[model samples]
Target: MNSLELGAIGNCSIAALIDGAGTLVWGCFPRMDGDAVFSALLNDARTAHDPRAHDPREGTFSLELVDQLHSDQSYLANSAILRTTLYDHHGGVVEITDFAPRFALYERIYRPPMIVRRIRPVKGRPRLTVRVRPRFDNGGIRPEITRGSNHIRYVSPAQTLRLTTNAPISYLIEERPFLLDRPVDLLLGSDESLQAGIETTARDLFERTWDHWRSWVRSLSIPFEWQDAVIRAAITLKVCNFEETGAIVAALTTSVPEAPETERNWDYRFCWLRDAYFVIHALNRLGVTRTMEDYLRFINDIVEEATEGELRPVYGIARDTAIEEVVVPHLSGYRGFGPVRVGNQAYLQVQNDVYGSVVLASTHAFFDQRLGYPGGNTLFEQLERLGNRAVALFDKPDAGPWELRTIASVHTFSAVMCWAACDRLSKIANRLGMADRASYWRREADRIHTIICEQAWNPDVGSFVSTFGGRDMDATLLLLHEVDFLSADDPRFAATVDCVARTLKVGDYLYRYVAEDDFGKPKTAFVICVFWYIDALAALGRRQEARELFETVLRQRNALGLLSEDIDPRSGELWGNFPQTYSMVGLINCAVRLSRHWEEAF
Candidate 1:
């Protein structure tokens, strides 16, 4: 079976998921939202009832070391490169390094749609087996294979894949074991001949890619504490970005259910405004502005396309305006769970937080001088339209961040975001010397803030309610301090934090909410909410407790130091979409908040 103990390797373009045993279980080629070329992670179904039900060697590209006794996986420091070592019974060992080549080429970033694997013997005589099975259209069809002198090509209607390697083509084609005496290199990409020898090309790309990533990490302004964690999180975030259109997908995969039998799975390959906003917010703390600038352009394109002053919470990577949700019946869900799905229906729902997200993201363009598309009067005018929508909808009920389909209560989080939109717009206007507009937005912000305080607060519970006057509490309230809606020391804010801590915190993990939603009660804790709680605790002078909890959350990350969206609270197993942007953003945000300054550390 495929494992959540998975490591990710990407080049800010395409990505793949490799298990602890050095198998490529999941990957989508060409782009983040493309059809899965390696769908074994989802298709391979082995159950207790039918122990040999599915093909054991069907969907993975694995390097099998004969007589394997032990295996482990980790990423190269400060890079997306993954290294997996397999040990044999007779003290033989083989090391496999996996990465998608990314570096500077021809004055532009060279991030090809490819994955490279280099294998070398570390000790004694080692035997190896290479199994390559690639499926097309979400594992529904296997491509037609054709062989060349030293390469193999898989062609389908969707795309063509070529595998160039130095290993014997006959052994690869026959899926047979062979004794390893020399290093082997494999590069999987378009149908093109290798300009140099396989070993020379792979080694050169590996070294350059390593140098490129290390240099990029060195350029980051990370926190003194948890530097490694923050760096990994940052690199993961970068991989989520689709450099082609400047859009950042919420996650790389789709239909990985949040919990068993809950059917809470949703496709997360599309970009969500709120998720992107949080990503920018977290990365901004690291002084990394490239993602912000790219995302700004992406958001602007969405804003510019608005015909009726309306925007969806999510959009396609190529800015496809409409995304109709569909379920692929052929491929079973991850682990044989059915209803593998694509496209997101949340785009159809009205989410008020998106307006605040757009404004918050756009407002930074005005202050950051490093941005290429700096904000001006034209941008301000466009954003004022969104602020107007925020003012009109903040009090009105729609789907909040929880995306409740049946319920539309006046969510306080939505209202607070509306307040944020106006507040930031007012500041931005003031910065631009638009005195009258600044005053107007400030008045609007004050009005919304006052109404939220009056209507959302429940004196009976001594805390702010999730919905206006409702007793239910949502985890989004923990962000009230981060948005500057209230001071960390404010009695009401602290009381809200305590209330959420009591109601939502389930032994260090926080649920999005307790109440039943579209998918009954959420079975797993949302990882991002728990991170918010840690930040809340740090804000409330519970630094030691928060630090302990933060460390616990860090430990929950997979062997590759990556996290999915939800977690089994009791077991600490990752669930939901793989390499969730929100979870990674939370990692960076908490690290920045809790880490000591470098100057002070010295």
Candidate 2:
């Protein structure tokens, strides 16, 4: 059966049944960046026809694969618990459920060796089919599979996987098509045996996972107006987090094109300094100070490990700064989009805004007194040095916030962040009683504010332009309120917000920046930008408008309450990478802001 509409239902049926093989269609394991075991999402042909296909529907197979089954899926309320039900034309019903255990005493820095998947027959005695095809190292290497008494093992140099079955059934491994198919009552762990007192252990582990999530959710103090949305957004953020390092990736998948068939797809599975500050603000407001501390420590470690002139705009989960962009010809892009890319080359581009973003985060940390380590003050000093560097290079042409393929004049957003960094440094130093350096930073902040107001704002349009001496309006300027660069009620701020509402709003969603003047045509609606607009509206006392817009954007969340980097407004389908952290962060912040407003106004 050629099925394409399948999506995550609650914490249930998160697994995808592709073709006839029971290969994990798209899962990142050992960590999010670790090679995919089954990457059919990247290259279906290679996955389906490779020598390692696991097709269970070969001959007299107990499992009957149905392609056209109408399916509906949802998660258990306020939890990542997903459930998907399949209704067949033959009046047979089946349900598949999937979830990873969330809580264990193991250090958050280590990953457990297994993912649990359970399938149950709801109505009829529908014969269950099982296929176990695992492509290791991101489908780049095929492992040697060995059969155990009640389990199967795929062993390779970098990793090992073991699958355990419950019921007795015939198992077969094919060579040309590279597949393994079997009929089994239950499919269990890949590396360990489940028959010798392992099933109970697995079930207990699953329960603990659910309990961990529940405890975390219950601890949230979200107000009534946004309880449900905030919970979902918070959980989605947790999913994007690399538990081991406390660093959160911007998105799950890589190379989902921003503009279809174009080379605009970039890997977003790294932590951006720009996201760190807002992340702290959101988590802290929600009373999740631990995550905030983790992020602060991660940032400090990055700074400590850095050599002079070696600060990067972003880094991998493990703090690696090497992300060279490359296209994989082997895999056909999503929905026929071509040239699926692996790494992000934007790492090499100069984005002056990162310094400001880091400083903003540090400023928030300082105010909250959540700075984790002894070197927190020293790190702030390093940031001030970077601020000096920013002032020297601020006027030069470089890639802006969008990291456009081509360099341009001084971007208004970059300058605004430069202003924010100096502004934050002054605030932090003064608060810490360092009066000597405070005046220098304050003067620098004043100079940047004046320069941006004079050179970046266009009096003709009464709105801040995207670049110096440019006429285009950018959605990024919405961040003026976020950085305290401009008051939301400021007339100039209102004019800029109105400019964005007129030009950038695509339906209820917003675009990152104007596309005609830059590389690649403008495409999907940037989900996070829409949330930024909602936050700005709320800050301006436009609560009704903000709530309405926030509801509209929330409607675009996927079946599992997940969000991608972009949304196709015309079709309302998720377009960019899956479960983007920035989108979730925006959701949490907007919900918190609007909910507080609702509570007070009511």
Best by lDDT: 1
**Overall lDDT per candidate, in order of appearance:** 0.89, 0.67
lDDT of 1 by residue, 1-602 (tens): 55578898999889999988898988888877887888777664547564425675676798998999999888899999999999999889999999999999999899988999999999999999999998888777788999998899989987889999989999998989999888999899877888988898999999999999999898899989998889999999999999878888999888888986778878999999899999988888788788898888898888888975688999999898788888877666677765678888898998888899899989889998877779999889999989999999999988999899888888899899999999999999999999999999999999999999999999999999899989999899999998999999899989999999899989879999999887788899999999999899999899988899999999999877889999999989888999999999999999888988889987
lDDT per residue for candidate 2 within 1-602, as digits (tens), equals: 21222232112112222222223455555566655565665553225554434332221112233532666666666666555566666665666555655564755422354555555667644544455566666666667877766666778888787766554424434322211122123443336555444456556655776777788888877766767778887876766666566677776667666756566677777788777566667777788777776776777777667675346788888888897777766555555455667778778888888778767766666677544443347767777777776677666676888877665669988888888878888888888788977898999889888988999889898899899998987789898887788987799988889898898988878888755645556777888899989988888889999988888888777655667778877877777766677888898888877775544766
State how far residue 243 of model 1 sits from its true place (Å).
Answer: 1.5
Error of 2 at 383 (Å): 3.0
TM-score per candidate, in order?
A: 0.97, 0.87
User: Which stretch of 10 consecutive residues in model 1 shows the poorest summed lDDT?
Assistant: 44-53
Best by TM-score: 1
